[model samples]
Target chain A: MSTATGLRRLTPSSFLLFVAVLAVAASAAALIVVYRTGGGIISDQERAEALAERDLLEQVDVEQGLDTLAAGVTRRALFATAGQHFGLFDARGQALAGDLTTFNPEFRNADWKVVRVGVKPRYTVHVIGSTLNDGAVLVVGRSLSNLRRFERSIFYGFASAVAIVAVAGLAAGLVMNFLILQRVDAIANTAERIAGGDLSARSPVADGRDPFGRVGVSLNAMLERIEELLTGMRTVTDSLAHDLRSPLTRVMGALARAMHEGATEDERMDAVEVAHDEVERTLNTLSAMLDIARAETGLSREMMVRVDVAALVEELADFFTPVIEDAEQKLVIHAPSHPVIAHGHEPLLRQAVGNLLHNASQYAGEGTVVRVSVEENQDTVDIVVADTGGGVPEDQRGRVQERFVRLDPARSSGGSGLGLAIVAACAKLHGGVLRLEDNHPGLRAVLEIRRV
Target chain B: MVEDDAEVADYVAKGLRETGYTVEHVPDGRDGLYLASSSSFDAIVMDRMLPGMDGLSVVKALRAASVETPILILSALGQLDERVVGLRAGGDDYLTKPFGFSELHARIENLVRRRAGRSVETVLRCADLEMDLLARKVFRAGKPLDLLPREFKLLEYFLRHKDRVVTRTMLLEQVWDYRFDPHTSIIDTHISRLRKKLDEGFERPLLHTLRGVGYRLSEQP
Candidate 1:
């Protein structure tokens, strides 16, 4: 691997190791402080004991006599405890009445020092010496093996602590790096597969309990939306081809008939008119499709204004009343006494409501009563158009909202099969929905738009 | 007319000329602006997309230069706000592409007639039919006719542009204040009902349907 990647992988582990090193250094400093203080305390106690012993022997010499002092030293040395010792020597450096085997002339006037005494089993001692009368010397000492043993144990304890901390830090760092890299790799693999044209691939989301899992869940949702759009686009293209082709073929046939040499002027004119009507139909279909696409994009949201929806619906009801009456159907409008207002693109809202009314008039059959009502809720406004005619089945409600989907092929001749689709798009643009419901014996299309 | 498409420009010029209009066409926006500012015409048909300069810029430049000739913008862009943009850029009217010649002709005629500056009249009369704009009433042959508010508005528009071709889109926009085209013959039904009220017992019919084109409210056939 490149040095960059290697450094990246080592970053977390290295940071943890640095922290461990800091901890070890701090602990070592503390241990050294304890060791030094303990050794100083031990040395002070040993020196005090040696000084007291010397003083006591001197007192004996002063109170009793040199002979008595010498005898006392001999008695104490012969029955000494484990960490006690004494020595008495003449000025001539000769051992007198103590267990001290080796003696030096320097010991005659030594106040305090550490010396080695005895032969076969050597002993290290803290000693104090003083000159006595009649050219004699006395020494007092204590063994220092206990202080050495304590210092050694402290050193070993600190060394073991450092070892344990280093090992644990390394292990934890490795485990953390493994877990992070595994999660990252899983996400990367899923992304790579999707980029390689596998749209079905999704990042594994065990749960949304952690940041990584949340990212995976959202990523999968995004992929699902993308796939849905792609499928929708495919369906649109296929339907567009099938729907446009038939009308275009008819137009071509009419034109061919008009261009035929044997055709009379009247025949030619009729053919031309047929072609013209077919082309107009095709243009209308194309424009409706464009309207639906534009509404879906919601690009004209900047043009939204506060529109009195009830007034608009009333106006529409007025506009469609004559036509519905001509069809032998009665039109009724139920609107609030006050203005029902909403924020929306007025033209699109009008078009959506107009489409619903047109749909009802076209399919509600003769003698059916069409009702147009505007109802205001807390956060939404619904413009409903219901007709007492044969209604769409529940299963076909959702399918009818799709582009170029017609429930009845017989009723498809006059429309582009995109009326409800445009209405749905317009509803979505307004942050709402178009719901098709059963009005007992007919269809009730409610176009709900946000109040804002 | 300022247009870049040769066939479309030819077709429009030919149709207007056949209708007794002295037609002038320019394929470039700068030239169209120069000609329009330099000369006077009844109306100008400006294409939105043109060579050398865009149509909206030309319209703005002309308006800035104080050329007050009425302009009708022709655009392939049929977006909802595109018409508003064109009108806001000093255009008197907006016509989407793939329009019928009669629709274009009717719009041009309306533009020219509007430029003629008829004073606001309280009452509009076409033969025996009369509409009182202020009173919101209509009378045929000196007898009062009961009309709904929408029907009154529709008749008022027809009387305002009497003896001229009025397309369905025009009526939808002028009378109903809507832009979307209804699939059914809703306009036809409305007009037929109004015709029943206006010409039901009259000796001569005034509202005549110009088959395959539109309707014409003329005293003569």
Candidate 2:
């Protein structure tokens, strides 16, 4: 196959196959060397045996005659003790002695060789040949089946070892892949659940030191922020509906009374007046809510400029003092001699301060002292409106700043509960905060805004 | 009057006619612009949203054509930014929607009055009641009257638009620069106090209440 095709088919098994091929090649080369060396050792031993037999025959010839030595029983006994075959051939190529019935062609010229001798059980032998003193040929052979068996055993051992190593490597790789995929699948499942609107679901962070763990942590934080914003929006919508329903119901009732059959002309006029008043009140509430909403949208950033908070407070005090006096309340305004400047929408700041003052003199009972003060620090400008009347309870102080949260509904005057909410929105828009504090005997509402 | 909604147009036109002013109504920006440029009118009331063209563009087009009639923008967008946009587009005044007719009438009267008196006047007088604008003082029958600063401003707005009905919203806006509704009867209380100073000993009352509408300060009352 082409290299590209081989690479495409390469997997964990393919890697193991490559390792096995390397091991098999090495084992086969080693076996060939061993077989050749063993055969050489066998051939040397056979050649020594044939020489010893010739020397013994020579000795016998020296002692006696050649004809006598050839017919002797001593040669047969020597071959049997050596466990080898020895044949002597004369000049005419005829077998002379030592169990050689016929002459072998392979034993004619070469010095040594491995040749098969028997047919029934096929015995391979290492054979050595030499020319004798009387011009006769002598050949010696030794069986080599044991060396072949050893070679076979080595080959089998190497093959099995390669197979075992490759299997172990592939198993390890698969186990690691499965573990990683399980972790990744867990993360994906959590993401899917969150996408399906189950924001309560969170990604599992097993090891925070890992990259995936960090990503999960960040995602969970983002989800928390989203949930918080959604909850806040829901609360605002619910309260808006609740606050608008009252005036709407009153208007509907007045109109129904006006349309009733038993209503006289005076009663009809009174109903019309009542409906008009209720409609105006509803419009006022809606407009105030819109103002708060606008501040929250952050669209007023373009209108931001350096506002003289002290000047604005002075103006509000001037406008409300008469109205407060008419309500039979004492109004005191304290402003710094130097200009107290901050960054915000001037009109919105005026409205926020005005709302606070309005709340103070209106909610705080008559004969109460209402004080308006403007103070500046290094970072913030605080416009505080304090009254010496019954203040909001400690727990209710925070709740009172929420939209449409009216305390003691039975004690409500003509004002909607959106004034402080608008003030809070404006404070947030200006990158500041609103705080409600106790003035010992009354409520002190402070609107803190960032300074330029 | 130029308003796209037929109901609103008829209602405003009828109200103006009942107040004894000759009125003309158009329900589209194109027609309104055409009539405004071709004919002479004392004043124009334009809605911000119209059929053929928007009110701001119409005002821009009229100003570009040199039609110098005073224009009052009537818009449902009551934001301070919207008010700034309308005035910058050459509208003499900006009135938010769902307004009381008395408020609309008062704004339109002020716009027309501003256009009529282009030359600066230092003194304003309604019969024996007189205000010296440069001196910031008020006099009745050659006798000096002591009035609070806010009352003086209230009387000054009245003197500027004498004999015309001024709504409570107008007084709050023109005098105190407050654009919100007065939750209490602050204006009424202030007006009663000012009346005590202006007509307490005088035979004739200068400030007359038009129930269900507003107050009209005139010699006849």
Candidate 3:
């Protein structure tokens, strides 16, 4: 309902959000994999080291007594190692012997787990404890700072990756928004120009593969059609003025003569008659122009029905036959006996075909033959009126089909010059085409309509 | 008369007066409605567009007030479907503008005569020509005359308006119901043929062609 560019409503920010979410998920997955593999390696190694120390202490305790084991030189060697610590405790949980006994002892019995014990620069140590048979306790701890450092590095890297991906997605979204707005603005500006009466204005076409390009093509086509219609309207207006003004002027001249003081009664009567004739002629011209306008605007489509083209053409031929024969011309008709139906308004079709036949009668000349034929194909029915008189020049045939474009001065006397124009309009309204072609010795006017 | 244009109203009123009919003209729709409802008249000629109210509204209001005087709507918008709208708005008849005065006068008289005759009549006679409505038969001077269906309808219209001028347009509209004009002289051909049939063996010609006006089927001529 807003008629605004839909780009803003379906904004590019949502796409940016989606990209950001995917980046976060991928970064999280990488961090989790790194943490699990690295942590597992360090924990497994630390557990093995603690188990070996515990086994050593248990063997020494079983083979020798707890006091003898604590007093052995091997116990000192174990405590003296670089990344290992050992402790011996009595049943009161006091460290009897170890390298560092100054740490607090919060120990669990018979378990292997990591413990943070020291105050400054705390060491995350994986420790194992066992209870000897003589009510003594032994503990072993391993340092894990190297593994922790590696994991911290991986975490920082993942965090920065997520931040960079999010920023890049936002920048891309902004650029896309700018491009879409530019294209939309171009279309709106072109439409505004066209609405302001610049019918020649058109939108710049984009690449054919993109939606914007297709939209531009369609908009340009619409503008072209509007321009054509506007140009046609101007032509019709000018022709109407030129056609009606002459008759009106003649009427005025005749009336002026009748009103002259020196005119005799009989002369004034003749002038009155002339004035009346001119008035009628002007009215006829105006009416014909109106009819053409009406038909061209599709006002007659509301009266559409199924019309038999063959029957209609035959009837028209019969009606005009006597009239043509009376004028000393031969009238020939050729039509199918079967019904060839089309969707149309009967009166409008009649008027269109009648105009063509009347043109033939008037312009085919005396003693010449005018032939009307109805030909039906799969989808169309063509009613053709051909005459054996002086035909229109090939170059002027197109112009003569236009309103008020009379090619023959001698043939232009009685007609308002809208006969063919009306026929063409009617044919168009009925979803058909009107063609003017050259007969062997005359003109052939064909009005083709869609069959029902 | 209800019309906005002074020239048109004056011209129509003068023509009606020349034809020996009393004329009264009102300029706009409001006063026209007021006078038509309060007084009695033979017929009212109303224009479609007026200063106060439109012709359709005025007709609707009068008909609502039970004013049965015949109303003829005159409009400049003569599209193919416009006449239907005018008649649907309670107008007795609709005539488009740029019309000949004879056609207008004939239509107005027809409307008035139609209003005056309330009861249906089965037989119509103009001088020696008699037509039976139910039998579809015509007798001229007590002699049966054969007529085609179209000729019969044309004669019926002529007999209906025996002493008045009926224009070619009136005939086309009343008989064939064609609103658009034909470029050929179809009506003239039909009329000439009908004239030959009616006057071929008759003593006096009842159909008279008035130059510059139209045809009349009357005994006085």
Which candidate should be chosen as best, given DockQ against the real structure?
A: 1
- Candidate 2 lDDT, B66-110, residue by residue in tens: 998999899988765576679889988888889887888888888
Which regions in candidate 2 have their CA more than 4 angstroms from the true location? A1-194, A199-229, A259-266, B64-66, B182-184
TM-score for candidate 1, residues paired by index = 0.77
Model 2's CAPRI class? incorrect
Where does model 3 exceed 4 Å of error? A1-114, A117-164, A167-171, A181-185, A188-199, A207-211, A218-222, A256-267, A291-357, A364-398, A426-452, B64-66, B79-81, B118-149, B180-184
lDDT of 3: 0.80
- Poorest lDDT segment (10 consecutive residues) of candidate 2 chain A: A73-82
- lDDT of model 1, residue A237: 88
lDDT of 3 by residue, B150-213 (tens): 6788899899888988887777566665555545366677778778888888889999988767
Give the proportion of true interface contacts each model preserves, from 0 to 1.
0.50, 0.12, 0.03
Candidate 2 — number of clashing residue pairs?
0
Q: What fraction of the native alpha-carbon contacts across the interface, defined at 8 angstroms, is recovered by model 2?
A: 0.12
Q: Residue by residue across A113-166, what tens digits does model 3's lDDT show?
A: 667766786777667777778767777776666576778888888878888877
Candidates arranged by lDDT, highest first: 1, 3, 2
Cα lDDT tens digits, model 2, A235-314, are 87897697678778888999999999999999989998888887877777777777777787777667788878887788
Give the number of the best model, judged by TM-score. 1
Instruction: Report lDDT (CA) for all predictions.
Output: 0.87, 0.79, 0.80
TM-score, model 2, chain B versus true chain B: 0.89
